[model samples]
Target: MRPNVRLELIRKLMQQHNNPSFMKKIIVAILFVLLIVGGGVAYYLYNKGPLDVISSHAVEISAVNLYNSFLSDSAAAGKKYAGKVLEVSGLTEDVSVNQNQETIILLRTSVEGAHINCTLEDKTKVNANKGLIHIKGICSGIGDGDPDLGLPADVYLTRCFVINK
Candidate 1:
């Protein structure tokens, strides 16, 4: 209505808004939430990067739901993820390390006849002492895998090991 009344109203509003403590707490809370969400998004995006485009490289992408890929799929996976350090989690079964010590790791995936290998950086001994373990390794091109060489080697597992869960 009147100018003086409007000025009083403005002053009241300013006083209510000048809550530094509350403002600080709200800012902190907002920042905390943003940091957490940002970190999660960064992690998720990092895990699902250019390599994991779900084009053959990703044996089991969290996004899509399809199974029973062909044996050659590894080749595609390799091509997509070549020279890149990628992580693929799968059940370890029939794992073995050969004399060459390439560390042949076997992973079980949802796709039938479709398997993914997490090639480790170093060779491991196929000792009975080592129990079933989750593995992480470098992604190598589907070349003359260990298995192609012979028993165990034919599996083409290189730089293998048991993943610590």
Candidate 2:
């Protein structure tokens, strides 16, 4: 039994020596793959930002675009993007107060008559009696809005804060 075990260990070492190229190739491939993945992760961390827990009562209209795109195509988005901090600039319209009595500032895309439906989750929907305001908030994204509402309501963030410019 001892002899057999020694032989087996020797066989393994011989097999490994005979396939040094194969092992080298595997190591190189793994290293290349790791570099690519690590670079991607580093880039994401540097550019996209930290993966901190995000909770906001208000967000911006850019969330509308993100949500609408997701709603227009649900399979394309994930929960990671919903109701996060945002910076958006657009023409404010269709100011509606939610059942919670929150103000949602509907945004019209800079394009002629291109409108996106949006709602505030915990925001105070100040009457946009003032037209064409820029918005920022904490938005919750739901599936796209129904056809009757038109456009999309992919994300709904309550107003944590807003800067009307």
Candidate 3:
């Protein structure tokens, strides 16, 4: 019985050594799958544009409600609204272009509270002097200020489109 067990162990070891190509094939297969998956992900990301709030269903919110929510608990608000499409309707406080040539629309809730700073793709679409407007944008996140330029902007929204002016 002991001799048979030893013989079986030796046979298994010999089989494993002889089947080195099995491990190689498995490794090659895994690497090939990873490469294909990575390429597919890259292609999808490259072609896919930002979320269009105009065509899709978005959360409708007033600028004041959005501001108050963020002001109360920024982390919770950010988790809820960040990267999501939103339709924000409010009075336009100011409109200006940043260094990147993006149109920025500031919608202030009050004098002291936070404001929703929406960045639009086209500056020509929105008039800088407009009053109340409805903007559809992707909420980026809340901001206290710009440390580099010393600008104090509150909530930041990007990829914005003016639904109504």
Candidate 4:
């Protein structure tokens, strides 16, 4: 009876080792677990909220200085300021609503035709008559200009809000 039991166990082990269905089952189980984990991550990211720039800490800088940094060395300035929230102070050159109905503020720079373009998060009216207004936004880096058209490089910021300081 002991010999028969040992033979039966060895036969079962060999069948399991040679069975393609056993390997297929294991592969299917692993794939199922991976799919579940992937779906969970996708769900979490899909429900995530947008960044709250109003409460976030920002780097304080002047519009001219920020523009000059990018003009002097774009790679260095981009590493320092791009995708970062900045509190920029400058004189208002123009304020208007774009086709998307978002408020766009242009801050004057030292160079001609060059401005710090800020796209506000909301449709808030800003009085350009006020001098040296401070704006907080995510710096989007500089936009190259057309020298033939007499346009200078412009700095861009998005999701901006007026900081009353």
For each candidate in turn, give its C-alpha RMSD to the true structure in angstroms: 11.3, 13.0, 9.4, 7.0
Which runs in model 2 stand beyond 4 Å of their true positions? 1-68, 71-73, 109-130, 147-154
Question: Candidate 2, residues 54-124: lDDT per residue as tens digits?
Answer: 34343334634654566556545445545466655555666787687766666764333345445554454
What ordering of candidates by lDDT runs from best to worst?
4, 3, 2, 1
Where does model 1 exceed 4 Å of error? 1-76, 111-114, 118-133, 143-157
lDDT on C-alpha atoms for all candidate structures = 0.48, 0.57, 0.83, 0.92
Kindly provide the TM-score of model 1 when superposed on the true structure, using C-alpha atoms. 0.37
- TM-score-wise, the better of 1 and 2 is 2
Give me the overall lDDT of model 3: 0.83
lDDT of 4 at 35: 100
Model 1 lDDT at residue 81: 51
lDDT of 4: 0.92
TM-score of each: 0.37, 0.42, 0.64, 0.73
Worst 10 residues of 1 by lDDT: 60-69
Instruction: Estimate, for each residue in 42-156, the C-alpha lDDT of model 4 and write its tens digit.
Output: 9999998977899999999999999999989999999999999999999998999999999999999889889999999988777867488999999999999999988898999
Q: Highest lDDT, which number?
A: 4
Where model 3 places Cα greater than 4 Å from the true spot, the runs are 1-46, 146-153
Error of 2 at 94 (Å): 1.0
lDDT (C-alpha) at residue 101 in model 2:
76
